[model samples]
Every structure is written in structure tokens, then in C-alpha cells.
Target chain A: MGAGHAHTLHHVGDSPVHRLPAHVKIVAAFLMVIAVVATPREAFWVFGAHLALLVGIWVTARIPVAAIAARSLIEAPFVALAVLLPFFATGPRTEFLGLSLSVDGLLAGWNILVKGTLGVLISVTLGMTTPVRDLLAGLARLRVPGMVTTIATLMVRYLEVIAAEARRMRLARVARGHDPRFLWQIGPTVRGVGTLFLRSYERGERVHLAMLARGYTGSMPLLGVPTTGRRTWAVALAPAAAAVLFATAGYA
Target chain B: MTPSLEVEGLAFAYPDGHQALFGVDLRIEQGERVALLGPNGAGKTTLVLHLNGVHRAGAGTVRVGGLEVAKPHLQEIRRRVGVVFQDPDDQLFMPTVGDDVAFGPANFGVTEPELSLRVKQALGAVGMGEHADRSPMHLSGGQRRRVALATVLACDPEILVLDEPSSNLDPVARRELAEVLLGLDRTMLMVTHDLPYALQLCPRSVVIDEGVVVADGPTRDLLADPAFLAAHRLELPFGFSV
Candidate 1:
């Protein structure tokens, strides 16, 4: 949302993928994930096709391969879960390298690793191409629940302000000779959080009053009516449709 | 022609038994920019809130364009009275400057063509015509303040009530904002502790303290009264003259 500054996840570019409407991208990303999820775990080559499709998008969008790899580390916890499955999952056993491994467990592990990684990669690519503000706008255009979208929009707007306030309060606390690191010394830190909450709540009431002053009765009004047309959807959803075809064709 | 605003015996008390305004009365003509000067807790904000129906009239009546600010006319009253809040953060809550400015008019059912025109005209008035798509948070504090003003301006209200418009502004930003406020033609009721700002922007001034209008006169005469200022904790900056 920066005045000409692109967000970290969103690379500034005029690529065909980037120029596509945000709602179209949102729908496309969602369908890609759905196709990944719906694909059979045994279709290993189809999973490979999915990865190639995403990588093609990455190249077209001009996002660095390393950046995608780095950002995808957010799925490391799931990776850990996948790795542990073969050891902990109770199923039919098989011998491999002098260790009895559960065959079903190994298959389950591969399932999670491949499907989860593909899902996360598609999401990461989506994040890399679209600004967070536009993402929320797309959600609204897709007829997401009003309350959910409203709360999300506000939260995105205020997150930085609240973070900066927290930083200043922390500095002031330090200046006043308070160390919050010690377990026994967390009282002041906790109190600071409470103070921040109260301040934020009071600010919300003031903002609500400000909104009321400007003729806000109950619902929020739409600022931009998304004009994403049929052609844009057809073009944007092509890759997702291809992925779906790959999943359905049993390409493995 | 009717006065732009009329408030008579407007009284309000909090649920905790703290009375903020007790029988406050004021009148503003169609094009007068009046400074509502007061000490802290003097109910300046309370009175301004009543103008827009943010706070209901507990006792007396408030009318804008001869329309009472009662339940029946709340919407019309709000549409006619645009309040610029103290913190720009509170006012500019939308994603973009254009969106924020358009919020007020769109709520009153102003359709697209006119809405965009209003947004453009308002932003142009504030010298922010090119910032229609920019996020308010990305702009400098002064720019954000101007955008906040544009948000109210898009509504084209009969009266503009500003709360501490110059509170957090630097010297340059304050002067720039003062220039903008001085150029506007609407009736303005500005609540501020900035004495010099009151002198620069408003010709008429009213001092309200302890829930009452203590003094009402020309801005220069009121600021020059040392005893009157001291009684209300209103202090002009050092070496500053009227």
C-alpha cells in the first residue's frame, strides 16, 4: 500500500501475470491450490507438472527462484511433520536400510510433503505477485463476508501504526530503567500490552465517531467497483485449468 | 437566510455522572469561521460532537441549515456538518486517499461520476490532486492531514468542525494547513488550544470553560486580554504577537 513502494512479497513489474486483475489472480491461485489438493498422492509426475507450472509462472512474473525458495520456508513446520510421519505413523512395515519403516507411513509422508509443498508454493507465488491491499480488495470483490473483509482491511491498515506504537513504548520503558527480559520482570511488559490495548480500543471508538461524523450509518461503502471482465478470467484461469487437467488425466 | 449552525442550551453528561457540557449555547452564520477556544476538559469537543449528532442533544437544540439535529434529521445534519478529527489516522481509514475522501459522499448515495468529481475537486483543493491512488499512511504527516480535510470536503458540508487541526503539525505544516483553512469558504468551527493558529485562521473566537461560553469577540481583542487568557490557561507562544 506504499505510495509507489511495492511490498516485499509483491515484486513491481508489468508482466502479463502481474497486470491481470487481482480478483482474477485470487481465483486462479485458489483454483491452483484446489487442483493440487485434489490430485492423487500416487500421481508423482502430476505433482512435478504442478511444480513446473508454478516455476513457469515464477519466471514470467520475474520473481527470483531463490526468493521463492526462501519465502517457501514458512512451510518448514509442515515439512517437519511430513518427515516424522514415516517413523511415527502406525501401518504395514517394510525394511529399508536396516530399519523397518511403515510403508503406508512413508506414502503418507510423501503425500504431505508433495501436496503441502505445492500448495505453499502456489500461495507464495500469489503473494509475490499481488499487493496485500489488493488481495483484500479481491476478497471483497469475490463476495466474501462483509464483516470479515472489513475487519481484515482495518487490521492491514493499522498493523504498522500499532507496531510503531509498541516500539516507542518499549523504548520509553527501557529509558525509564525497565528490563523486560527477565521472567520475574515481565510485569511491566504485560502492563504495557494492557495499556496498548486500552489505547487501541479508545482509538477505535474515536475512529468510529469520525466515521459517524461523515455519514456512516451501518455498512461500509465500496470505493472501487472491480471491473474484472470475462476475458480476464478466462486468460488468468488458463494455467489453473491446465493444472486441473493434469490432475484429472492421471499423468503419472 | 438561516444561520449555518445554531446551538441552544446543548447539555451532555457522561454515564459516570461527569457533566461535560451544561447548557451550552452558540450561533454561527453561513460563512463565519469561528474559533472555539477552551482549556482542557472545557467541553469544546463535546459541543462540536453535538453539531454532527455524534453526541445526542441531551437538553437543548442544535440545527444546521435550520434542520434540527434530532433523530429524524440526524442523517441530514451529519451530511451538512463535516468534522475533521484531531488525528488524521482516525479520519483517513480507507486504503487510498481517493477512497477515504470518497467515503463521506458515497454514504449519502452520491453516484460514481459525481463522487469522483467531488473527490478530485476536494483533493485538488487540498493540493493533493495527484495523490488520489496513494495510501494515506505513505504520505507525510502534513499530506495525511490535508487528505483528512479532503475527506470532509468531498461531502461539501455547510459547516466544517475541526478538532485540534494543528495539534501534531510542525511549523511549516501548520502554516500550510492554516493557508488551506483560510482559503475555504464554508463556515468553520475549529476547536484548538493553539492560540496563534486561532488568530491566523479565525476572525471570531469564543472561549468556553467550565461548560460555558466565557468570552465571545474578535480574535485579536480576545487574545490581547492577558487576564482573560490566564484565567483559562490559554497561552500564546513567547515573542508571539496578535
Candidate 2:
């Protein structure tokens, strides 16, 4: 009955961004990412503007810069890919600090770097401001297919339970002298996974029955449908709308 | 007035040819609290499932509030008969305790205003009104169990069927739950292996063994019969008496 351990990505706070309807925020985040993706890599100022917009959101949401940076490290692998692009791409050469580099490769690398970073940064902001359940409800409100939302909702609900079960099973195995460091112990570990899967499957069946016992028919009822008033859309989509303007101006 | 629950000639067998319940008959009056005592694999769960049509019996009839348990009546039957499964994780599958409590009623077309009110009332009944917005995963085991019960109670069921309600609860939680159950006015069928719990909460006890009702009497008398308890593979705590 205490305050739950909030997910690390979602810092609990009240702000205009956090107060916006989840569906509006979801749509705005989507549109902003699309705008960033469509912008030409050569439009360096537009990329800067987009970054500035995300930073504005972070500031408004009261999320710490260090927190955002730490969470954004999820893109490290993509960053590595972007870094490799200049070395591997074949194109017209250019001199940079007395070292030969491809002009086309540099542009491509910049494209990957700016666009991917913006995409991840936008997601981080969204995750930071909205809880997972609200995000799911937002998806439902956005008219995402019921099947997908239901699967996702169930997955989110049971993930911790299954993880806890796995942990308990591991402890039981360890108590019985099973050492995972040895190569031969892999067999038991794999079998344990299979057993966990079977248990999860059975639990799903039981849960389905429980759902039925509570009058669950085919469709899961929508508890609270989010309403995005015109004002909310205008306010929430201001940055995204600006991105579209920037892209168009760059194209013109 | 109709009986809260009536089961006659209820029989069931698994697909693997393992007969779980064979011609089990039981009845409970309105607002009665009955404890169903049984050993493992004694068909207690199977009989419980039949109450709400989760598992259809091959032969027999089940009636809740005068409504027969059948295809067309399933919705009404389920609404009137709320089942709290053995595992709270299975029952409270929604993200938040509030959402889970509102799930059943919402499914039955209970809209907001009333929906939120029902959720609040149910959570209040279980003494979990403060944890409405919290994730079920983050709750203690006892809290989760209470939330699971709230999920069913929100539907305003006339009959509450609980399977192993006290299995994993610590002593404090168990006593708290017993108090909560005692306070509720709805008819309750508590299936459990806890003899002391049964005596404490249910005045009458029914023992099911090997798909049959071996004994039906007062809980204290049933627990006192060592031969009957031994025959059904049930035991009370050491030095504990009714």
C-alpha cells in the first residue's frame, strides 16, 4: 500500500508536459520523430533547433540533464554504428585535420547521428514524463489495435511476476549445489528456462479463466478514454509543428 | 428467496481421463459463510470452477441466485458469482490496483462515475483504498491478495468463491484477511486447507476427498474428528484445538 518503486525512466513530477493527455503527447512525440527523420542531413540548423526543442521539454518537465543523458545511453550501440560509417563509406575524399575522409561518408554519418539521437531523445522525454500504464492507455486511446494493446498490457503486468519466479527458481537450484559457472551446468539452466516457460503458459491459462470468472468477454473495456482538447493539441504539438515548419523552410 | 448457491450431481474429468469431481453436491444459503476443506487434488478447485462456468461439468447443474450455470447465463452467473483464484498474480493482472479492481465491473458495462466509485468502495472493503494507483507488482503479497478480492467485489457479486485464500499469507495478514472476510456481508465459500482458519471464519465445513464429500458438519466437530481428518490427509497445527 506504499508508493510503488517508480521506473527509473519515469521521474515523478507535475508539470505542463506531464499534465498533457497521454494520447496527445504520444501523437506529438510521433510527429516530432517523423519530422526529424524527414529533414535533410545537410540542414544542420534544423537539427540544432530540434535538439533545442527537446531540451526545452526536458527543462519544462523538470527532468535533470544528467538523468536524461544516462537514460539516453541506450543508443550507445547506434552511436557506435554512426561512428563507423565515416570509416567504411566510399565517396569523394575531403581533408579534415590533415586526415583523409569521405565527404559523402561524413554527411551520412551526420544524418545517422543527428536523426538517431533526436529519435532516442524524444523517446526518453516521453518515457520520462509518462508512466508505462498511462502510455499504454494512451496507445489504446489512439485506436491502436486492441489485440496489440491487450498483449502489451498483459506483458507489462506479468513481466515482474515471471522475473521473480525465475529468480526464486535460480535460488532453489543454487541451494541444491548447481553452479552456473561450469559449462555442464548450462543444461540445467536451459531446462530451467523451459520449465519457466511452461509455468508461464499455464499461468496464462489460469489467468484467462480468472478473467472469465470476472465477466471478461472478448474485448477489454476501456477505463478512461483520453480526451485531447483543441487547446491541448495546440500546446502539446507546438514543438512538433515547429519541426514541420523547419523542415519545410529548409526544403524551400 | 433463492439459495445463494446450489450444485447437484456436479461431475468433471480432465481431458487426460483423470476424473477430478464425481457427482459432488453442495448448497449454501444466502449470507452463509462455508468453508470447503480438502487435500491436494481433491477436486475442490474443479467444483469451484463449475460455480461460475469456468469448467463445465459433464453432468449436473449449478445455480447461483436462481440462475442456472450455462452458456446463455454465463455473464449473469459470473457477475453474481465472483471467484478469487488461488494465485493473486493470476487474478489481479491489471497494471494498478485501482485498474484491476475496476476491471470486472467495467467489463460488465459499468461506466465512469459509477466505475470509479465501485473501485473505491471495493478497495475500501479490502482496506486498500490508499494503494489504488500503485502497481500490483509492487504490493506486498497480502495486499495483492486483497486487491485480487477487490477485483471481484467491485462486480457486486452475491456469492464469493475463494480458492486457498490463506495459502501464502503470513499470520498477521491471514488474521487481517479473516477480519475482512468476517466483515463482508456476502455469502462466501472459502476453500482452504487451514483448519484453524476454517474454524475461525466458517461455522460449517465441508470436506471433499477423491472427488467426493466425505463429511459435512460444524467446523469444530469436523476438525475434532481425527479419523476423518487423517482419512482426508488434513492436519491441524501441533497443540492447536478448536
Candidate 3:
């Protein structure tokens, strides 16, 4: 799980999407989501147009459609909630395939589907383009609490180690003839989770001591010599502005 | 010059009923490289943890660079003593190699430009300057260890407390690590089971067994004493007795 998740989320590339400052991408994505959410449910054409814009961005960013689709499907279960809404909502009923469907339900379904799809697309795009470090940097730049970033940085770094430890424990259990298939076996699985938490907590303490030994005063030092020049800021803001404008029009 | 580390009657026990260390005493002079030899559960790690007050001195004093180990002076003591854990995974807890190295310096409040320079210098020392942007998870075990060293090196601590510096490393990588350690000029206290590595890298050897310091002398003499090693649950690898 660690290897696979780490591999999928982080890819090094020199594309424009990759080069843009993380803060810009985050703000742009948030705005795009807000735009999609605020758009009227009756505006199906606008949703179609927004989806096309996202697709264009993905194509230009050189991200594989299959990867995006696969990620999209991971969220499909939540999307199913919206898929079912059309059957229960109240409004003028319309006959479709000899079954009555409420107009309000149909609109509600469209609203959820469009907003959720756009939100997921924006997030997936950001994840595909930005490395986790830059994402944290972007958050830091945007005034995220230092403690939060520190925790996140530590979490991402040790996530693989923790996952590997979990895998080893699972393998050990399997070797001991413990198959976690039945409900009764779930108690042991939950205990395994508790053990993982304890191990992680202990590891965190040790790591903290190690950090203190290395002269860690409090704040994490910034690297890469950030140059907040007008050009860099301009480069970051251009796409964001364009995204906001497009989303605003869709809302209007 | 004052000793880089001076521990007298050091002892520690977990909050639970289990005791991990008994009375221990040791002294390592400045610029001296010493290897702490022990088996698993030999309290080598517990001793290392005391150098920077990580484990806290249960009943003794731990003085690093003339400062006593106490709550008020912890930050200053920590600044002087850098520790690298056995697991690189624990030490390098940042996304990119550069960021991980920069973490220590950043925590110490080094200015941005200086922090960048420190990061470059540390990574360069480990021959990993090119990997600064790369994620640590993608690196090999040896590379991860090197990066781990760089992370601590970035802080520029006067004393380095390394736990198992050569474990799980291939021969070439171990040789590379040895070369790197030899090149470093700081006072080093390395904990390891690798006898040859201890002999090659450190002039002094300190043996801890069952949480007590059993032997402390020149590496050659300690390794030469077969009975002393046997008494401490340590033995020369195979037929290669020292």
C-alpha cells in the first residue's frame, strides 16, 4: 500500500503544471470547486463545458486519462449517493421508460454529479502535477500552521515505513495461520491496528528525540532558496486567474 | 580541549518496571571517534539516547561540551550533539532529500540562503547533491543512510551520535560509509554490531552489555581480548577472531 500510493501520487516532471508554485495550484483548484458548486443545476451545458476545460488541462499536462479515470472511479461509491438522489427527490414527475422520476431529483442528481466530478478532477490534477514537498511548501506559503506542515511532512515520510511494518505484521499473522476473513477475526485485526498506532507513536517519540539531537529549535528550515520575484508570482497567478474567470462565467 | 561527551554513573529505565540501563560511565574526548559495540538489547541505543537527553539521565550526569544534561540547557546541548538513528526511515522524515536535510537547519533558525547552502554542502558531503529534489523513498538503502547523515550534518552539530551506521549495508556501501565517516572531523560516537566497521572507523571501543559498561579501551585491545568479548555475549565473526 505504501509503495503503490507513494508511486502513484508523486511523479517528477518539468511540465508547466509541475513548474507552477503549489500555492497557486491549491487556490486555483479550490476556486474551481467553488465555481462548479455554485453553478445552477439546470446549466447542464456549462457543466459540459467545464468538463471539457478540465480535459484540455489534463491533456496539456500530459497526464494519462486512464489514471484520472481510475482515480475517479475510486470516488464512484460516493458518487453513487448522488446517482440515487433522482429517485427520491420531490418535484414535477416525468415519465421515463414507464417510470416516474421527479424533476427536482433529477436536478439534485445533476448538481451533485457535476460538482463532485469537477472537484475530484481539480484535486486529481493537482496531485498528479505537484510533488508532496512542493504541496507542503505551497501550503506553508499560504499561511498553513507550521505544526500542521511539520506533522504532514513527518507523516508522508514515515507513511511507507508504517505501511511496510503493517504488511510485515500481516504476513506474520498469515504465517501463524490467522486468516482475517471472518467477523470474529476482525477483533484481532482491530488489535493489530491498535498495535500499529502504538508503534507509530513510539516511533514518533524516537524521531523527535533524534531531531532534538540535531539542533532542531522549532521551525523547519526552508530550502530551494525561494525567489518570490514578480515573474515567478506572475507565472503562478496566470493560470489561476484564467481558471477563476472560467469558473465565474460558468456560475454566472 | 574538553571531552566531547562525559557520562558518569549514567542509568535509565522505562516508565514501566523494565530497566534498560544500569550504572554506566564513559568519556570521549573532542575529535575522537569511538565505536560503541554491543549486541541486540545491549543498551547501546539507550546510552546514545542519553548524549542529547533523549532518554534523560536516570541517576547520573551526561555532559556534552561542558554543559550538564538538564531541561534548561537541552536546546543548547542538542545543538552540540547530532544523532542519526539506525533506521534512515525515521531520520529522513521529509518528502524530498533536500527538505529532509534542511529540516534540522530550519529548526535551528538558519536564514534561508544559509539554509540552502547548508543543505547543498551536507548533500554534497554524502555525494548526493543531485538527489536533493528526489523523494527519499525512491533511494536505495545505502543512499537513504547517506541522506540521513546529511540531514543531521546540515545542523553542523559538534558531536555526532550514530546508531548502527553500517548495519544492513552491502560491502561497497559500507566501505563508502566508512570513508565518509573517516572524512568527517567531528567527535563521533557510533553504536554498531559490525566489529570490523568499529575497528576501522573508531580508535576507541566501548562495550555495553546488559545495560552496564563492561569494557572501554582502544579498539584493537578490546577486539584482541577474546575472553572479554565472550563475557559480553559478543564474538568475532566465524573463524575471524581478532
Candidate 4:
């Protein structure tokens, strides 16, 4: 529930990015990612342009540089896999800074880093501006499976409750003089996780019944009377469209 | 007009061989606000669950609005019976208040325009219209409870079944909830340990102890009877004899 927690990633703002329709943003993000992935690794200039375009968009959206850096750092571990490729990969050997590296490995690493960074940036930007509900609404609008959207919606809604339950359970255990610190004490933590899972499962059943009582048959309805104006779509697509054209010019 | 609800010889037992309800029988008239008072493990919830076909009756029948609560009428029964669970967290499962409110109507196939109107009107009824876009978790306990009620109200049910509706509310919120309940025109079956809330919101009362109806009468008269309330583990607040 703390503001800096992963679940609380959304930043309240009045930027155009914040006002963009979720469905449009979702589609645009997907298209941008596909375009990035399809771009060859040798297109170094295109990658540079892509990064520049993203940076420009981020700046125009008024997202804080510190926030972006923190999120990128959080995502750094996944990108670290790509970083390792340059050293471990087998190809024509090259020496740099007293270390051996491979030509193919360098290209592989560059490809992953650029593609992964772009993908993560798109997702992080989406998460930071749009509330979780809007994301689900957007997914629903984009014809993602209803069940998938419903499950994601339910999961996000109950995540806090589940986390709170875990916290309460931990406190209760600690009050009973259970100190789970060392490897040997991991038993209690495992048992706690198991208990949490069971509690969550039971809660799901109860929630289903509650839904039934409220006349829930299956599909969840769209949130808010969607006032999807042309301006909203136009604004959302501008950055993605610009990025695509910029990346395309690199193809020429 | 037919009664809002009728249960005859309704019995249930868990798979572990523990019988919860032992041939319980009850009748609720149309537009009647009745409180179902019982101690813990007295099958109060088990009985209410039967009204909407959540819990199947083991040995008898549950009828809502003249339709038998069977598989064929399950959806219809649910549409007409709005159940507000004790835990608002469990009730409001959707991410936003608006989605949660619209859930019931959406399932029942209310058109888009009608659905929006119902969601708005329902939230308005609970005085939570401004919070439609807000996440349910972000709301206070009272607000969540109001949204939970709105979720049910959106379905436009004829019989509102609320379990411990005022359990966790502060005094002001509890009073706000009481006023909201009072304003609703539908027949309500409220299950609660709070005798005062029952007395305030319901005209009639039914006592369930050990899976059976032990007493049924006017709320005031029943609460006034010391022996009757004590028999079912109910007590008026200190110095507030009924």
C-alpha cells in the first residue's frame, strides 16, 4: 500500500499521456514493440533514433527522469542477461579493456539490450500513467480474452487484501515468538506462503459467490462510460506513429 | 402478491458430516424488512445462501418471488436477490467501483446505455457517484461497504440480503448505512449480531439457533424479551433494555 511499492506505480498527473485512451495506448505500445523487434540488430542508427524518440516522448509526457531511472534500474536485472552475452558468446575473439569478447556475442547483446529496453520502457510508461483498472479496460476493449482480463482485474483488486492478509499472518506468527531468519527457520515462511495460498483460494470462492449474488453471469462490464473522443486516440497514437516512422527511415 | 421468500424444511450438511441447517423453515412477505439473528455457526449464512441458490438445499425447498430456486431458475433468482456479504473486500472484486457496480447489470445483459445509467444510479443511491473511477481498495471501509451495496443495488434486486452490513462501520458510517438501507424500498433480509441495527432497520425478526428458527416476531417485542434474546446468544447493550 505504500506509494513506492510495485503495485502503486501509477503517478497522478494531468499530462496528455495520462488522458490517452487505454485501448489506443495498448495497441500503440504493442505495435511499437513489434516494430522494434522486427528491426535488425545492425541498424545501430535506427536503434539510436528509437531511443531518442522514446526519450523525447518521455520528456514530452512530463514523466520524471528520476522515476524513469528508478523503473529502468528495477528492470536492469532482466537486461543483465543480454549484457552477459557479449562476454560468453563464441565467435571471432576481440580484446577490449583487458577482456576477451566475441563479435556475434556483441551483436546479440546489443539486439537484446535495445529490444528489451524498448519493451520495458513501453510497459513501464504505460504502468506509470494508467491506473490498473484502465489497463484492464483497455485490454478488454482490444479484445483480449474476457477471462484473462477478468482474472487480471480480480488479481489486481485483491492483491492488496492478500498482501495485507500475509502481513497480518506474519505479525501473528511473530507475536507468538516465531523468528524466521535463518535457512532452518524457512519452514515457517514456506508454511506461511502455503497458508496464504489456501486463504486466497477460499477468498476466490467466496468472491465468486458474492459475484453471483450480484447477478454476475460471466463478462465484466467496461469501466466508466468510455468517452472515447477522436482527440484521445490522436494523442495516444502520435508518439508511437512518430517512433515507427523514425525507425522506418533507418531501414532506408 | 406472492411472498418475497419462502423456505420449507431446508437442510444442509457439509461434506465432513457436520449438519449446518436442520429442516429450517421461514417465510418473508413482499417488502418486509426482516432481520435474521443468530449466534456464530448457527447457519444464518447457510440459510441466506439458499435464497440465491449458492448453497443447494439438502432436504427441502427455497423459493424466491414464487419461483423455486432450482437450476432452471438460478439466474433469475440471482437477478432478483441481491446479497451483500459480510466482507466488502470479497463483495467488490472489480478494480474500480464503476466496474463493480456495473458487473451485476452487465451479467444480466442490460444494454450499454441502461448499464451506464444503472451504474450511475446505483452509486448515486449509495452516495458514491464521485468514486466510480476510484479503485475499491483505495476506499475507506465505509466507502467499500457502500460500493458493495451499490454492486447489489445495480442489479435492481427485489430482495436485498445483507450479512452483517454494519459490522465494521464507524458510528457516522453506520448511521449513513442505516439511512441508505431505510431508503431502499425492497424487502431486506439482514443477518447481523448487532441487535440495535436490526431493530432500527427491520420491522420483524427471526432467531436461528442450532440450525432452527427458535423465535419470530416484531423486532421491538423480540428484543424486549430478555429470555428470548438470551436463548439465541443475543443481548441488548448495557442499560439499554429492550
Lowest-lDDT window of 10 residues in candidate 1 chain A? A1-10
Stretches of candidate 4 exceeding 4 Å from the true structure: A1-7, A224-252, B15-17
Residue pairs of candidate 1 with colliding backbone atoms: none
Find the 10 residues in a row with the least total lDDT in model 3 chain A: A1-10
Residue B165, model 4: Cα distance from true site in angstroms: 1.7
For residues A1-252, what per-residue lDDT tens digits would candidate 2 score against the true structure?
Answer: 212443667867799998898889999999999999999888889988898888899889998998889989999998898888777789888887897888888889889999999999999899888888888888988899888888888998898899899999999999999887878769988999999999999999999998898898866788876556799899999999998888777676
Interface root-mean-square deviation, candidate 2: 1.8
Candidate 3 structure quality by residue, lDDT tens digits, B31-80: 99999998889888778878887778779899988889898978777777
Please compute DockQ, using alpha carbons, for every candidate against the native two-chain complex. 0.76, 0.73, 0.56, 0.63
Estimate the Cα RMSD of every predicted model relative to the unseen true structure.
Answer: 2.2, 1.8, 3.4, 2.8
Clashes in each model (backbone N, CA, C under 3 Å)? 0, 0, 1, 0
Where model 3 places Cα greater than 4 Å from the true spot, the runs are A1-5, A10-12, A52-56, A59-67, A173-197, A217-219, A229-252, B9-23, B38-42, B58-60, B209-214
For model 2, how does the per-residue alpha-carbon lDDT over B1-242 read when each residue is reduced to its tens digit? 79999999988999899999889889899999999998999999889888998888899899998889999978999999999988999998888889889889988889988999999999999999999988888888899888999999999998999988999999999999999999998899999988898999999999999999989889999898888798889999999865
Quick one: best TM-score, which candidate?
2
Residue A129, candidate 3: C-alpha displacement in angstroms: 2.0
Model number with the top DockQ: 1
* TM-score per candidate, chains pooled: 0.94, 0.96, 0.86, 0.90
Q: How well is each residue in B1-242 modelled by candidate 4, as lDDT tens digits?
A: 89999999999998889999999989999999999998999999889888899888899998888899999878889998999999999998876688788888887878788889999999999999999877787899999999999998988987999999998899999999999889988899999999999999999999999999998999999999898778778898887866
In angstroms, the error of model 1 at B138 is 2.8
Docking class of 3: medium
C-alpha DockQ for predicted model 4 = 0.63
True-structure lDDT of candidate 4: 0.85
